[model samples]
Target: MNKEYLIRWIKAAGIRAIKTMAQTAVATIGTTAAMSEVNWVMVASTAGLAGIMSLLTSIAGLPELKV
Candidate 1:
């Protein structure tokens, strides 16, 4: 397993996580707008988790793993 490969994997994962978070955020907002009363807490919680995942993935990508 090359270090560079691991780094690349981490970078890819980070990108994916970010994209997923964005999509989820958009969907949640759209749904909330459509509904009169949305579970704000749930939406916030999920978004928070996604944000954390994105951050972790980004940090992992930062490590200069031998690619």
Candidate 2:
């Protein structure tokens, strides 16, 4: 692949990662008082889902809205 394509993929992945982490953190930490208790499996699953979504969007492009 070209450098530009690689860069796009990296950017997409990073964005997805950050979004996933934020959502997971809020869900886990916002409702609980225990800061030390965290679910690693749930975090990993969220990351994986984010990665897959980003990859799919990058490859297929986003759908256009219809008026």
Candidate 3:
């Protein structure tokens, strides 16, 4: 892949990863979750895993990916 395509893919993947992380964090937090009682480590790890999965999935196919 060319530099331009690589850049575009990175941007697309990054955005997707961020979105996934946000969604995961919200879901993990839940409506009844208390801030003080929240499992911060669990939430962070779950969100991080979701983001990483999103990034890996983007490698299979993404709008910005030429191939």
Ranking by TM-score: 3, 1, 2
TM-score for each predicted model, relative to the true structure: 0.59, 0.49, 0.85
Ranking of candidates on lDDT, top first: 3, 1, 2
Model 3 alpha-carbon drift over 4 Å, by segment: 31-36, 64-67
- Residue-wise lDDT of candidate 3 within 1-67, one digit each (tens)? 7888888888989999999999999988883286456787899999999999999998888965666
**CA lDDT scores, all candidates in order:** 0.71, 0.61, 0.87
For candidate 3, give the lDDT.
0.87
Angstrom error of the Cα, residue 19, model 1: value is 0.2
Q: Look at candidate 3 and tell me the lDDT of residue 6.
A: 85
Query: What lDDT tens digits, residue by residue, belong to model 1 across residues 1-67?
Result: 6777766876776667777777777778779878876777767777768877776766655444434
Model 3: lowest-lDDT 10 consecutive positions = 31-40
Query: What is candidate 1's CA lDDT for residue 5?
Result: 76
Candidate 2: residue pairs that collide: none
Candidate No. with top TM-score:
3
Model 2, residue 15: distance off in Å is: 0.3
Residue-level lDDT of model 2, residues 1-67, one tens digit each, is 6777667666765676577667765675544436566666765676567656665665654233111
The better-scoring model by TM-score among 1 and 3 is 3
